[model samples]
Target: MGRMKSSNRKKIIGALGDPRIKPYLEASGGNEKDALALYRWSVELTASIQETLGVTEVLLRNSIDVQLRKWNNEQLGHSASWLLESPASPLRSMTKSKRKEALRRAEKSATCRSASHFRHGQAVTHDDVLAHTMFGMWKDILPNHSPGADPEKTENKNRMTLWEDAVKNAFPCAEDPEGEKTYWRVAHLHELRNRVSHMDSLLNVDVLDVTRDAFALVGSIDPVLANWLTGTSTVSAVYGKRPE
Candidate 1:
Protein backbone atom coordinates (compact mmCIF):
# COMPACT_ATOMS: atom_id res chain seq x y z
CA MET A 1 0.00 0.00 0.00
CA GLY A 2 2.77 2.42 0.89
CA ARG A 3 4.55 1.65 -2.37
CA MET A 4 1.31 2.33 -4.28
CA LYS A 5 0.88 5.68 -2.57
CA SER A 6 4.40 6.74 -3.45
CA SER A 7 3.87 5.72 -7.06
CA ASN A 8 0.68 7.80 -7.25
CA ARG A 9 2.37 10.91 -5.90
CA LYS A 10 5.04 10.53 -8.56
CA LYS A 11 2.37 10.39 -11.19
CA ILE A 12 0.63 13.45 -9.84
CA ILE A 13 3.80 15.52 -9.70
CA GLY A 14 4.89 14.33 -13.10
CA ALA A 15 1.52 15.30 -14.48
CA LEU A 16 1.70 18.71 -12.83
CA GLY A 17 5.34 19.35 -13.66
CA ASP A 18 4.92 19.81 -17.39
CA PRO A 19 4.54 23.34 -18.72
CA ARG A 20 1.18 22.20 -20.03
CA ILE A 21 -0.78 20.62 -17.23
CA LYS A 22 -2.61 17.42 -17.98
CA PRO A 23 -6.40 16.98 -17.69
CA TYR A 24 -6.13 16.89 -13.94
CA LEU A 25 -4.12 18.79 -11.33
CA GLU A 26 -4.23 19.77 -7.64
CA ALA A 27 -7.73 18.48 -7.10
CA SER A 28 -8.73 16.63 -3.95
CA GLY A 29 -5.07 16.28 -3.19
CA GLY A 30 -5.05 13.43 -5.76
CA ASN A 31 -7.40 11.29 -3.72
CA GLU A 32 -10.66 12.57 -5.15
CA LYS A 33 -13.16 10.20 -6.67
CA ASP A 34 -13.85 12.68 -9.45
CA ALA A 35 -11.07 12.77 -12.01
CA LEU A 36 -13.12 15.16 -14.13
CA ALA A 37 -13.22 17.64 -11.30
CA LEU A 38 -9.50 17.37 -10.98
CA TYR A 39 -9.05 17.96 -14.66
CA ARG A 40 -11.32 20.97 -14.62
CA TRP A 41 -9.56 22.42 -11.63
CA SER A 42 -6.20 21.96 -13.25
CA VAL A 43 -7.19 23.72 -16.47
CA GLU A 44 -9.04 26.47 -14.71
CA LEU A 45 -6.34 27.14 -12.17
CA THR A 46 -3.64 27.22 -14.79
CA ALA A 47 -5.64 29.58 -17.00
CA SER A 48 -6.27 31.79 -14.01
CA ILE A 49 -2.63 31.80 -13.00
CA GLN A 50 -1.61 32.60 -16.55
CA GLU A 51 -3.67 35.77 -16.73
CA THR A 52 -2.86 36.66 -13.14
CA LEU A 53 0.84 36.39 -13.86
CA GLY A 54 0.54 38.56 -17.03
CA VAL A 55 2.95 35.98 -18.40
CA THR A 56 0.30 34.44 -20.63
CA GLU A 57 0.03 37.35 -23.05
CA VAL A 58 3.78 37.85 -23.01
CA LEU A 59 4.51 34.32 -24.14
CA LEU A 60 1.74 33.75 -26.67
CA ARG A 61 1.88 37.19 -28.32
CA ASN A 62 5.58 38.13 -28.25
CA SER A 63 6.72 34.77 -29.51
CA ILE A 64 4.74 35.09 -32.74
CA ASP A 65 5.87 38.66 -33.25
CA VAL A 66 9.53 37.59 -33.15
CA GLN A 67 9.23 34.71 -35.61
CA LEU A 68 7.49 36.72 -38.34
CA ARG A 69 10.81 36.75 -40.20
CA LYS A 70 10.93 32.98 -40.64
CA TRP A 71 7.90 32.94 -42.88
CA ASN A 72 9.71 35.02 -45.52
CA ASN A 73 13.34 34.11 -44.77
CA GLU A 74 13.21 30.36 -44.07
CA GLN A 75 10.77 28.06 -45.76
CA LEU A 76 8.87 26.27 -43.02
CA GLY A 77 6.63 23.26 -43.75
CA HIS A 78 7.79 23.39 -47.36
CA SER A 79 6.20 26.77 -47.03
CA ALA A 80 2.85 25.13 -46.37
CA SER A 81 1.18 28.46 -45.71
CA TRP A 82 2.63 29.88 -48.87
CA LEU A 83 1.82 26.76 -50.82
CA LEU A 84 -1.71 26.72 -49.54
CA GLU A 85 -2.24 30.40 -50.07
CA SER A 86 -0.54 30.44 -53.44
CA PRO A 87 -2.68 30.58 -56.56
CA ALA A 88 -1.03 27.22 -57.22
CA SER A 89 -2.36 25.53 -54.09
CA PRO A 90 -5.79 23.95 -54.25
CA LEU A 91 -7.09 26.52 -51.83
CA ARG A 92 -6.36 29.67 -53.79
CA SER A 93 -6.98 28.56 -57.35
CA MET A 94 -8.29 25.05 -57.57
CA THR A 95 -10.41 23.91 -60.51
CA LYS A 96 -14.12 24.55 -60.17
CA SER A 97 -14.75 20.85 -59.57
CA LYS A 98 -12.14 20.66 -56.84
CA ARG A 99 -13.39 23.81 -55.20
CA LYS A 100 -16.92 22.44 -55.18
CA GLU A 101 -15.70 19.19 -53.68
CA ALA A 102 -13.96 21.02 -50.87
CA LEU A 103 -17.04 23.10 -50.33
CA ARG A 104 -19.21 20.00 -50.26
CA ARG A 105 -17.11 18.42 -47.56
CA ALA A 106 -17.14 21.60 -45.53
CA GLU A 107 -20.90 21.90 -45.99
CA LYS A 108 -21.42 18.43 -44.66
CA SER A 109 -19.29 19.19 -41.65
CA ALA A 110 -21.25 22.38 -40.96
CA THR A 111 -24.61 20.69 -41.43
CA CYS A 112 -23.74 17.82 -39.15
CA ARG A 113 -22.40 20.21 -36.59
CA SER A 114 -25.39 22.52 -36.78
CA ALA A 115 -27.88 19.66 -36.71
CA SER A 116 -26.31 18.61 -33.46
CA HIS A 117 -27.35 21.99 -32.14
CA PHE A 118 -30.83 22.05 -33.67
CA ARG A 119 -32.59 20.49 -30.70
CA HIS A 120 -31.87 23.77 -28.95
CA GLY A 121 -33.71 25.80 -31.66
CA GLN A 122 -30.62 26.74 -33.64
CA ALA A 123 -30.77 26.67 -37.43
CA VAL A 124 -28.11 26.12 -40.08
CA THR A 125 -27.91 28.01 -43.32
CA HIS A 126 -25.84 27.64 -46.50
CA ASP A 127 -24.29 31.05 -45.95
CA ASP A 128 -23.23 29.98 -42.47
CA VAL A 129 -21.52 26.92 -43.87
CA LEU A 130 -19.74 28.90 -46.60
CA ALA A 131 -18.59 31.52 -44.15
CA HIS A 132 -17.30 28.87 -41.81
CA THR A 133 -15.41 27.18 -44.64
CA MET A 134 -13.89 30.37 -45.94
CA PHE A 135 -12.90 31.45 -42.48
CA GLY A 136 -11.04 28.18 -41.99
CA MET A 137 -9.11 28.88 -45.16
CA TRP A 138 -8.20 32.58 -44.81
CA LYS A 139 -8.15 33.66 -41.15
CA ASP A 140 -4.53 34.76 -40.77
CA ILE A 141 -4.40 38.12 -42.53
CA LEU A 142 -6.10 40.85 -40.48
CA PRO A 143 -3.54 42.48 -38.20
CA ASN A 144 -1.03 44.61 -40.12
CA HIS A 145 -2.54 44.76 -43.55
CA SER A 146 -6.20 44.81 -44.57
CA PRO A 147 -5.68 42.75 -47.73
CA GLY A 148 -6.07 46.28 -49.24
CA ALA A 149 -8.49 44.84 -51.70
CA ASP A 150 -11.33 42.78 -50.26
CA PRO A 151 -12.93 41.86 -53.58
CA GLU A 152 -16.27 42.60 -51.98
CA LYS A 153 -15.56 45.44 -49.63
CA THR A 154 -19.30 45.95 -49.62
CA GLU A 155 -19.68 42.61 -47.88
CA ASN A 156 -19.15 42.74 -44.16
CA LYS A 157 -16.11 40.68 -43.26
CA ASN A 158 -17.27 40.63 -39.67
CA ARG A 159 -20.96 39.69 -39.79
CA MET A 160 -20.59 37.76 -43.00
CA THR A 161 -18.12 35.57 -41.20
CA LEU A 162 -18.37 36.25 -37.53
CA TRP A 163 -16.96 32.85 -36.63
CA GLU A 164 -13.73 33.61 -38.45
CA ASP A 165 -13.62 37.11 -37.06
CA ALA A 166 -13.94 35.87 -33.51
CA VAL A 167 -10.91 33.61 -33.71
CA LYS A 168 -8.96 36.38 -35.35
CA ASN A 169 -10.13 38.65 -32.57
CA ALA A 170 -8.79 36.19 -30.04
CA PHE A 171 -5.75 34.40 -31.51
CA PRO A 172 -4.38 37.00 -33.87
CA CYS A 173 -1.07 35.20 -34.32
CA ALA A 174 0.93 32.10 -33.50
CA GLU A 175 4.20 32.98 -31.75
CA ASP A 176 6.88 30.35 -32.25
CA PRO A 177 10.45 29.64 -33.35
CA GLU A 178 9.26 29.53 -36.92
CA GLY A 179 7.90 32.75 -38.31
CA GLU A 180 4.17 33.36 -38.53
CA LYS A 181 2.18 31.72 -41.29
CA THR A 182 0.28 34.99 -41.37
CA TYR A 183 -1.76 33.42 -44.07
CA TRP A 184 -3.70 31.11 -41.78
CA ARG A 185 -4.27 33.47 -38.90
CA VAL A 186 -8.00 33.85 -39.27
CA ALA A 187 -9.11 31.15 -41.67
CA HIS A 188 -8.34 27.72 -40.20
CA LEU A 189 -9.38 28.82 -36.78
CA HIS A 190 -12.86 29.47 -38.21
CA GLU A 191 -13.36 25.77 -38.81
CA LEU A 192 -12.44 24.92 -35.24
CA ARG A 193 -14.32 27.88 -33.85
CA ASN A 194 -17.54 27.17 -35.72
CA ARG A 195 -17.86 23.79 -34.08
CA VAL A 196 -18.19 25.45 -30.71
CA SER A 197 -17.95 29.06 -29.77
CA HIS A 198 -18.37 30.95 -26.44
CA MET A 199 -19.05 27.82 -24.55
CA ASP A 200 -17.45 24.80 -22.89
CA SER A 201 -18.29 22.34 -25.61
CA LEU A 202 -16.36 19.09 -25.65
CA LEU A 203 -15.04 18.30 -29.11
CA ASN A 204 -15.08 14.92 -30.77
CA VAL A 205 -11.68 13.26 -30.67
CA ASP A 206 -11.21 13.44 -34.43
CA VAL A 207 -11.92 17.16 -34.51
CA LEU A 208 -9.68 17.58 -31.49
CA ASP A 209 -6.88 15.87 -33.38
CA VAL A 210 -7.35 18.14 -36.39
CA THR A 211 -7.15 21.26 -34.24
CA ARG A 212 -4.04 19.90 -32.59
CA ASP A 213 -2.48 19.36 -35.99
CA ALA A 214 -3.32 22.91 -36.94
CA PHE A 215 -1.63 24.07 -33.75
CA ALA A 216 1.33 21.90 -34.66
CA LEU A 217 1.55 23.58 -38.06
CA VAL A 218 1.95 26.92 -36.33
CA GLY A 219 4.69 25.48 -34.15
CA SER A 220 6.56 23.95 -37.07
CA ILE A 221 7.23 27.40 -38.51
CA ASP A 222 8.96 28.60 -35.35
CA PRO A 223 11.39 26.90 -33.01
CA VAL A 224 10.74 29.30 -30.15
CA LEU A 225 7.01 28.58 -29.94
CA ALA A 226 7.29 26.15 -27.06
CA ASN A 227 9.39 28.55 -25.05
CA TRP A 228 7.00 31.43 -25.74
CA LEU A 229 4.09 29.22 -24.78
CA THR A 230 5.85 28.56 -21.50
CA GLY A 231 6.11 32.29 -20.77
CA THR A 232 9.76 32.79 -21.74
CA SER A 233 8.93 35.60 -24.19
CA THR A 234 6.40 38.28 -25.06
CA VAL A 235 5.31 40.33 -28.09
CA SER A 236 6.98 43.43 -26.67
CA ALA A 237 10.37 41.75 -26.93
CA VAL A 238 9.40 40.15 -30.21
CA TYR A 239 8.39 43.48 -31.83
CA GLY A 240 11.35 45.15 -30.13
CA LYS A 241 8.83 47.03 -28.00
CA ARG A 242 11.42 47.60 -25.26
CA PRO A 243 12.91 50.95 -24.25
CA GLU A 244 16.42 51.69 -25.51
Candidate 2:
Protein backbone atom coordinates (compact mmCIF):
# COMPACT_ATOMS: atom_id res chain seq x y z
CA MET A 1 0.00 0.00 0.00
CA GLY A 2 1.04 3.60 -0.59
CA ARG A 3 2.25 5.75 2.33
CA MET A 4 -0.51 7.23 4.48
CA LYS A 5 -0.63 10.96 3.80
CA SER A 6 -0.09 13.21 6.84
CA SER A 7 -3.63 14.56 6.69
CA ASN A 8 -5.02 11.01 6.61
CA ARG A 9 -2.74 10.02 9.48
CA LYS A 10 -3.99 12.96 11.53
CA LYS A 11 -7.59 12.00 10.75
CA ILE A 12 -6.93 8.40 11.75
CA ILE A 13 -5.25 9.41 14.96
CA GLY A 14 -8.08 11.77 15.82
CA ALA A 15 -10.68 9.02 15.23
CA LEU A 16 -8.78 6.45 17.27
CA GLY A 17 -8.09 8.88 20.11
CA ASP A 18 -4.64 10.28 20.86
CA PRO A 19 -4.31 8.24 24.03
CA ARG A 20 -4.82 5.02 22.13
CA ILE A 21 -2.46 6.01 19.30
CA LYS A 22 0.24 7.51 21.50
CA PRO A 23 2.15 4.30 22.12
CA TYR A 24 2.38 3.57 18.40
CA LEU A 25 3.60 7.09 17.79
CA GLU A 26 6.36 6.63 20.34
CA ALA A 27 7.29 3.23 18.90
CA SER A 28 7.62 4.82 15.46
CA GLY A 29 9.93 7.57 16.72
CA GLY A 30 7.19 10.21 16.43
CA ASN A 31 6.65 9.62 12.74
CA GLU A 32 2.94 10.01 12.11
CA LYS A 33 2.90 7.75 9.05
CA ASP A 34 4.97 5.08 10.80
CA ALA A 35 2.72 5.36 13.80
CA LEU A 36 -0.29 4.68 11.61
CA ALA A 37 1.49 1.69 10.16
CA LEU A 38 2.19 0.36 13.63
CA TYR A 39 -1.43 0.98 14.55
CA ARG A 40 -2.54 -1.18 11.65
CA TRP A 41 -0.09 -3.86 12.74
CA SER A 42 -1.54 -3.68 16.23
CA VAL A 43 -4.99 -4.26 14.82
CA GLU A 44 -3.77 -7.33 12.97
CA LEU A 45 -1.94 -8.56 16.07
CA THR A 46 -5.08 -8.09 18.14
CA ALA A 47 -7.10 -10.05 15.61
CA SER A 48 -4.61 -12.89 15.66
CA ILE A 49 -4.61 -13.03 19.43
CA GLN A 50 -8.39 -12.87 19.57
CA GLU A 51 -8.70 -15.85 17.24
CA THR A 52 -6.39 -18.01 19.34
CA LEU A 53 -8.04 -16.80 22.52
CA GLY A 54 -11.40 -17.98 21.20
CA VAL A 55 -10.12 -21.54 20.81
CA THR A 56 -8.38 -21.48 24.15
CA GLU A 57 -11.50 -20.23 25.91
CA VAL A 58 -13.65 -23.03 24.52
CA LEU A 59 -11.08 -25.70 25.29
CA LEU A 60 -10.58 -24.47 28.81
CA ARG A 61 -14.29 -24.12 29.57
CA ASN A 62 -15.36 -27.42 28.09
CA SER A 63 -12.56 -29.32 29.83
CA ILE A 64 -13.43 -27.79 33.17
CA ASP A 65 -17.14 -28.31 32.60
CA VAL A 66 -16.62 -31.98 31.96
CA GLN A 67 -14.93 -32.51 35.28
CA LEU A 68 -17.48 -30.40 37.09
CA ARG A 69 -20.26 -32.46 35.57
CA LYS A 70 -18.70 -35.71 36.73
CA TRP A 71 -18.05 -34.41 40.19
CA ASN A 72 -21.42 -32.79 40.59
CA ASN A 73 -23.18 -35.92 39.40
CA GLU A 74 -21.19 -38.04 41.80
CA GLN A 75 -22.11 -35.76 44.64
CA LEU A 76 -25.76 -35.97 43.71
CA GLY A 77 -25.73 -39.72 43.03
CA HIS A 78 -27.18 -39.29 39.57
CA SER A 79 -26.37 -37.84 36.16
CA ALA A 80 -27.24 -34.16 36.52
CA SER A 81 -26.09 -30.86 35.10
CA TRP A 82 -23.51 -29.14 37.24
CA LEU A 83 -24.54 -25.57 36.56
CA LEU A 84 -27.96 -25.62 38.19
CA GLU A 85 -28.56 -24.09 41.62
CA SER A 86 -27.81 -26.58 44.38
CA PRO A 87 -27.40 -25.61 48.00
CA ALA A 88 -25.02 -28.50 48.55
CA SER A 89 -22.95 -27.63 45.47
CA PRO A 90 -19.63 -25.83 45.81
CA LEU A 91 -20.87 -23.04 43.55
CA ARG A 92 -23.59 -22.15 46.09
CA SER A 93 -21.39 -19.68 47.89
CA MET A 94 -18.96 -18.75 45.16
CA THR A 95 -20.17 -18.68 41.53
CA LYS A 96 -23.89 -19.31 42.02
CA SER A 97 -24.82 -15.74 41.27
CA LYS A 98 -22.72 -15.64 38.16
CA ARG A 99 -24.22 -18.90 36.95
CA LYS A 100 -27.71 -17.68 37.72
CA GLU A 101 -27.09 -14.46 35.86
CA ALA A 102 -25.66 -16.23 32.85
CA LEU A 103 -28.53 -18.70 32.75
CA ARG A 104 -31.05 -15.89 33.07
CA ARG A 105 -29.47 -14.11 30.14
CA ALA A 106 -29.49 -17.30 28.13
CA GLU A 107 -33.15 -17.87 28.87
CA LYS A 108 -33.98 -14.29 28.00
CA SER A 109 -32.26 -14.78 24.69
CA ALA A 110 -34.08 -18.01 24.08
CA THR A 111 -37.39 -16.32 24.77
CA CYS A 112 -36.63 -13.70 22.16
CA ARG A 113 -35.65 -16.31 19.61
CA SER A 114 -38.49 -18.70 20.26
CA ALA A 115 -41.77 -18.81 18.37
CA SER A 116 -43.79 -18.94 21.56
CA HIS A 117 -45.14 -15.74 23.06
CA PHE A 118 -45.83 -17.25 26.46
CA ARG A 119 -43.15 -16.86 29.18
CA HIS A 120 -43.82 -20.33 30.50
CA GLY A 121 -41.44 -22.32 28.34
CA GLN A 122 -38.17 -21.61 26.60
CA ALA A 123 -35.76 -23.94 24.85
CA VAL A 124 -32.60 -22.79 26.57
CA THR A 125 -30.36 -25.73 27.36
CA HIS A 126 -27.45 -26.33 29.68
CA ASP A 127 -25.03 -25.78 26.82
CA ASP A 128 -26.66 -22.43 26.05
CA VAL A 129 -26.19 -21.32 29.64
CA LEU A 130 -22.63 -22.55 29.60
CA ALA A 131 -21.96 -20.69 26.38
CA HIS A 132 -23.24 -17.49 27.90
CA THR A 133 -20.99 -17.65 30.97
CA MET A 134 -18.04 -15.29 30.84
CA PHE A 135 -14.39 -16.37 30.70
CA GLY A 136 -13.86 -14.84 34.13
CA MET A 137 -16.38 -17.21 35.63
CA TRP A 138 -14.21 -20.18 34.72
CA LYS A 139 -11.03 -18.47 35.86
CA ASP A 140 -12.46 -17.45 39.21
CA ILE A 141 -13.56 -20.99 40.00
CA LEU A 142 -10.02 -22.30 39.83
CA PRO A 143 -8.07 -22.80 43.05
CA ASN A 144 -6.23 -19.61 43.97
CA HIS A 145 -4.45 -18.02 46.89
CA SER A 146 -6.28 -15.99 49.48
CA PRO A 147 -3.67 -13.92 51.32
CA GLY A 148 -5.30 -13.32 54.69
CA ALA A 149 -8.15 -15.78 54.76
CA ASP A 150 -8.05 -18.58 57.32
CA PRO A 151 -7.44 -22.01 55.76
CA GLU A 152 -10.95 -23.03 56.82
CA LYS A 153 -12.59 -20.01 55.30
CA THR A 154 -15.49 -21.04 53.07
CA GLU A 155 -13.87 -19.58 49.98
CA ASN A 156 -10.55 -21.22 50.70
CA LYS A 157 -11.98 -24.60 51.51
CA ASN A 158 -14.39 -24.53 48.57
CA ARG A 159 -11.65 -23.72 46.12
CA MET A 160 -9.30 -26.34 47.49
CA THR A 161 -11.97 -29.03 47.64
CA LEU A 162 -13.24 -28.19 44.16
CA TRP A 163 -9.74 -28.38 42.75
CA GLU A 164 -9.08 -31.70 44.43
CA ASP A 165 -12.41 -33.25 43.51
CA ALA A 166 -12.82 -31.88 40.02
CA VAL A 167 -10.91 -28.94 38.51
CA LYS A 168 -7.43 -30.46 38.54
CA ASN A 169 -8.59 -33.52 36.63
CA ALA A 170 -9.72 -31.17 33.87
CA PHE A 171 -6.08 -30.72 32.98
CA PRO A 172 -4.92 -34.26 32.42
CA CYS A 173 -1.36 -33.09 31.99
CA ALA A 174 -1.08 -30.52 34.78
CA GLU A 175 1.46 -31.69 37.37
CA ASP A 176 1.21 -28.88 39.90
CA PRO A 177 -0.88 -29.22 43.03
CA GLU A 178 -4.27 -27.46 42.87
CA GLY A 179 -3.49 -26.75 39.22
CA GLU A 180 -1.60 -23.57 40.23
CA LYS A 181 0.41 -23.47 37.02
CA THR A 182 -2.68 -23.99 34.91
CA TYR A 183 -4.64 -21.37 36.83
CA TRP A 184 -2.00 -18.67 36.33
CA ARG A 185 -1.63 -19.49 32.65
CA VAL A 186 -5.40 -19.28 32.22
CA ALA A 187 -5.39 -15.99 34.11
CA HIS A 188 -2.73 -14.63 31.75
CA LEU A 189 -4.76 -15.44 28.67
CA HIS A 190 -7.94 -14.19 30.33
CA GLU A 191 -6.31 -10.78 30.70
CA LEU A 192 -5.24 -10.84 27.08
CA ARG A 193 -8.75 -11.81 26.06
CA ASN A 194 -10.14 -8.85 27.96
CA ARG A 195 -7.64 -6.47 26.37
CA VAL A 196 -8.54 -7.69 22.91
CA SER A 197 -12.25 -7.41 23.57
CA HIS A 198 -11.86 -3.89 24.94
CA MET A 199 -9.78 -2.72 21.95
CA ASP A 200 -6.83 -1.95 24.20
CA SER A 201 -3.29 -1.35 22.98
CA LEU A 202 -0.98 -4.34 22.59
CA LEU A 203 2.11 -2.13 22.25
CA ASN A 204 3.65 -3.12 25.58
CA VAL A 205 2.30 -6.66 25.70
CA ASP A 206 4.74 -9.51 25.19
CA VAL A 207 2.62 -10.99 22.40
CA LEU A 208 4.81 -14.00 21.77
CA ASP A 209 5.05 -14.91 25.44
CA VAL A 210 1.26 -14.54 25.80
CA THR A 211 0.71 -16.77 22.80
CA ARG A 212 3.03 -19.40 24.26
CA ASP A 213 1.10 -19.30 27.49
CA ALA A 214 -2.11 -19.70 25.51
CA PHE A 215 -0.77 -22.77 23.73
CA ALA A 216 0.53 -24.23 26.96
CA LEU A 217 -2.83 -23.71 28.67
CA VAL A 218 -4.60 -25.64 25.94
CA GLY A 219 -1.91 -28.30 26.01
CA SER A 220 -2.35 -28.72 29.73
CA ILE A 221 -5.87 -29.99 29.10
CA ASP A 222 -4.96 -32.04 26.07
CA PRO A 223 -1.79 -32.14 24.00
CA VAL A 224 -3.82 -32.71 20.86
CA LEU A 225 -5.62 -29.41 21.35
CA ALA A 226 -2.31 -27.68 22.05
CA ASN A 227 -0.88 -29.08 18.83
CA TRP A 228 -3.91 -27.94 16.89
CA LEU A 229 -3.78 -24.45 18.36
CA THR A 230 -0.04 -24.06 17.70
CA GLY A 231 -0.36 -25.41 14.17
CA THR A 232 -3.17 -22.99 13.35
CA SER A 233 -2.21 -19.84 15.28
CA THR A 234 -1.03 -16.83 13.20
CA VAL A 235 -0.09 -14.49 16.08
CA SER A 236 3.62 -15.20 15.62
CA ALA A 237 3.45 -14.39 11.94
CA VAL A 238 1.52 -11.20 12.60
CA TYR A 239 3.88 -10.18 15.40
CA GLY A 240 6.85 -10.47 13.06
CA LYS A 241 5.22 -8.01 10.71
CA ARG A 242 5.04 -5.15 13.24
CA PRO A 243 6.11 -1.80 11.80
CA GLU A 244 9.68 -0.74 12.54
Top model by TM-score, which number?
Answer: 2
Which regions in candidate 2 have their CA more than 4 angstroms from the true location? Answer: 1-3, 114-122, 146-152
Q: CA lDDT of 175 in candidate 2?
A: 82
lDDT of 2 by residue, 88-194 (tens): 46766678888888889988887776455564465677798888889988878887753454657778778888898888898888787866787678788888999
Q: Which candidate number has the best lDDT?
A: 2
- What's the lDDT for all of these models? 0.36, 0.83
Q: Candidate 1 residues 35-79, lDDT tens each? A: 434444434433333232233223333333233223322433443
- lDDT agreement of model 2 with the native: 0.83
How many backbone clashes are present in model 1?
A: 24
Off by over 4 Å in 1: 1-22, 25-29, 33-35, 41-98, 105-129, 132-135, 139-244
User: Distance (Å) between predicted and true CA of 196, model 2?
Assistant: 1.0
- Among all windows of 10 consecutive residues in model 2, the one with the lowest summed lDDT is 113-122
